[model samples]
Target: MEEKKFDINTLIGFVLMGAIMFWWIYSTQPTPEEIEAEKNKTEQVKEDTTVTNPTTSEIILQAGDSVTLAKAQTELGSFAYSTTLPSAKDSETILENDLLKLVISNKGGQIKEALIKKYVTYDSLPLYMIKDNNASFNINFGTTDNRTLNTKDLFFEPSLTKKGETQILSMKLKVSNNQFLEYQYEIKPNEYMVDFNIRSQGLSNVFNSSQQINLDWNLEGFRHEKSIRYENQQTELYYEKDDENIDYLSIGGEDDAEENDVNWIAYKQHFFSSILISEQAFDNIKLKSKTLVEDEEVDTTFTKAFYLKAPLALQGGELNYNMNWYIGPNDYQILKKYDRNIKEITNLGWGIFGFINRAVFIPVFNFLKGFIGNYGIIIILLTIVVRIIMSPLVYKSYLSSAKMKVLKPEMDEIAKKYPKKEDAMKRQQETMALQSKAGVSPLSGCIPALIQAPVFFALFRFFPSNIDLRQKGFLWADDLSAYDSVFKLPFKIPFYGDHISLFPILASIAIFFYMKMTQSQQMNMQQPTQEGMPDMQKMMKMMMYLSPIMMLVFFNMYASGLSLYYFVSNLLTITIMLVIKNFILDEDKIHAKIQENKKKPKKESKFRQRLNDAMKQAQEQQAQQQKRKK
Candidate 1:
């Protein structure tokens, strides 16, 4: 989830108009004497209205209360006609395309439920984007007759009509047949985004002049993945504010923030999201989120809760807005087409790491996936391609390490000569001189290794966020986006999780071997250790073991796709290193080249000359200080 720091805008094309006028339709509350007389007149008329089920949208009349006409007219004022327009029974209207199905309730004129047709939950149930009381959308405003009204608390009359390929559902809270607050939804076939336009007609004078209109949207995300904690770690609130800049709140925490000019709001639940988008700016927006699951919880029903509230415009006495509801998978390509920067919600990473995924790995992998059926084979091929691209750097690094290996005996002799504690600076100066004469700089090897870091980090961000891998099976893993458990444990391990994942175990073993193969070469290339400095060789050896243990523990719950990538990547690295060391590089030739280079006059770089001058100045200062102390 990416966040931008600024106020939020109302959804695209939201233009609020003043409430329309209906003067003769509304009447003031009846007096106590008139109410008593009305009750007396209704004593003989038996109250027979019974509700089998009541939704949140209904203001149900009690058994003892009068269902008389005049009482309702007094209470509803201008909206009294709503009682006659529709029965308060719980009725649902459905709008569906090839990919999505939405069940809208007439009670609140809100989408009561949604199902992504192409997908299902982890347990194989239908994947409902909104269900039961888990989600709601409501508008709040005040009426002129000293009364406040919430759309969710009133009954809306529903009408479904078609415009060629588009299906439009109009839910109206009416003052009359032609005058009401309208919640209009227009959905075209085969699209995940639905165009929603909210506007009222004819009742411009009924709404209170001093009141502000607001929209309250809330959702409780369902458990879609096998692991609650893992999915929850990825689930978060994302929005766009201050135009194109993006930021995100830390996951697994509760926060309340207000932003100005926010363009969109995305309630992300890992693989899928429910996003609200607008073209114009909405001000004074409040965003809130809270985690639902606990670390040691038993319930796994839902993952998190989210809330968004922002004021709406009332222009020309009518509430009007044009917006879109995007309820679908967090697939990068599908979202990129919206041009809302909606693709920012897909967690591909940020900056150059994101650029690499977008420019290199993603496009290449997508091209390969078009023809390939098995993801495991695709991963293997992907790893091989990346390794091949990086092979030149691998060769240069190994060649440098080999040259350093040939010079190790002389380097060790220098270490023995500069054994005294105070001679550390002198040791560094002599070592640089020898390496310069040999035409080698230690940083030359490190530069290639450094250049490859972005690719690794990019892949690390790519696999888990890649929805294409969500249900894709690879070798022993049933779902590549989740850990592959070969065995279940009766007892839980703290960081290692409750089950034994085969891919992480294999990945750990692979990295252990790769490190063992190359750490010694890195160890040989280390400069002479100064007094009080930690031993670089010992640290490297410790890391050789420590890295695998960390991988074994850390990746136990990470996506199997990532573990597979690391495993294949390490195996390829080991193979490349072996091929380079034994078949490609020759230490005898490297030594001859180093000896030949030594006979030529060395030209010190400007930076090196400054370093030599600084070392001489430091040594002279130390001698003078020592004489003064004596």
Candidate 2:
């Protein structure tokens, strides 16, 4: 019935359908000239977009079927000639010298691996300073088509040549037969240094001449030591800039920026280093380092990763730079010969302590090493020489201790006269006067002890960084540079470690006896029981026990050479103290000297007068308070 009525809504719908059909037919039909014009316009649009916003691998995949390599190349213009797409197969070129073997890959034209021929890892495996695709050297620039290009991703053609005792590897990425970017590496026999030179010709047509190029270098340092944690703690990135003092990143991990011109950058491991030295310093460098996770599977294989980005200014439509890569042991002599302050990579303490190590300990150690074949014997000789040099200070400290012991009876009488806590100030005043009369300065003992502190710390730094100590065998120790494990436990301990190191145990025992003897000597001295003073006797007792335990725990995972040094040094100290007590000094004679000195009239020094005045002021204040109370 509705169809028969021919409703107004049905009439409007019929009219709309007919109009759409007419429009579709009109839009579909075109003349030959129109079709050709449309095709050219589409191609032009594509070229414009590709040139302005060049697609990377990620962008190309996102474009799906809408983009093709053929279409992309057509839009590349002059850049298409220089572009070298990476292939699935990568080939390696080997450059070997007497001391080093370097593997360069065609994929990146950079060092893929570096092997130190004379050394091996702590586990006796071939030593690899750089390997496992862990190192990358890249040059990044913008192509003429606005494509972001990295030399690391492009394939290169490699050629080898020999000149006398030198081997040269040339890796070239060709734009044309006459135009290319080349990386030339030269290695000489019996040398750890490799000369690296980069040169480019006619690349100004492919790359923007106005823009600067960025060089990015990354290295993942593998662990060559027995202890991964120790190696990580010792590994650091060192760089020299502007001929100023050498600077370094924190050993574990850190990020830093260098605003000045940098001469060299070194990735220093525990026993070795990979250094890059540039003839022309690099400006505006950003460096970062990250410690590797301690995985049971890979802990012995790697220590940390480092990244450095530097900028280079291109000149006259060409890029030319020369650098040297020093891949070798962290030997002081070898690195010092570079004259680049590269030797500072060794952790030889800081300030005066470092000075002592460099000036005294290193020289002495080397001298001893020349004469002695056994490292253990050398350490003993070193301890003896150090103690002999410090004997005068040791004697002064002993004399001061003896004088204090002799004054114990006189000090006790003062304590008895001022029995109450309120009389502490008076007792201290009388004790000072008694000491002044006896000509015994209370600081004399501590001053000599403090003077020996730098030497102790100097030796602390020397042992671990000594490459000669690495893999050296001592009694019950396989590697003097690493912890000597007497027994390995199945389970790990928290503060103590998973193994018992014999050297640390022996060192702790020696330290305990040395402390006990020193504490016994200190106990003979009368300590004033002032109201606010810490109990010196109690503190001494605690230190006597606590220090040995700390040494045992802390030195367990330290270098065996260090533990051996401490053990020998402490034993020598105990022997020296015993000899001093038994033969060198007589207590009866010290007492006689104290009595003789007390009988003589003593003039008060300015410091003593000021101390007395201060004491009197305090007493006057106390008297005022008492009067007020009355």
The lDDT per prediction is: 0.84, 0.83
Residue 297 in candidate 2, Cα distance off native in Å: 9.5
lDDT of 2 by residue, 121-147 (tens): 887999998788889999987776666
Q: Can you write out model 1's per-residue Cα lDDT over 23-63, one digit (the tens) per residue?
A: 32345557799999899767645332344333333333331
Off by over 4 Å in 2: 1-89, 159-163, 209-212, 253-260, 295-300, 621-630
List the lowest-lDDT window of 10 residues for candidate 1. Answer: 12-21
Clashing pairs in 2: none
What is residue 384's positional error in candidate 2, in angstroms? 1.3
Q: How close is candidate 1 to the true structure, as a TM-score?
A: 0.89
Best by lDDT: 1
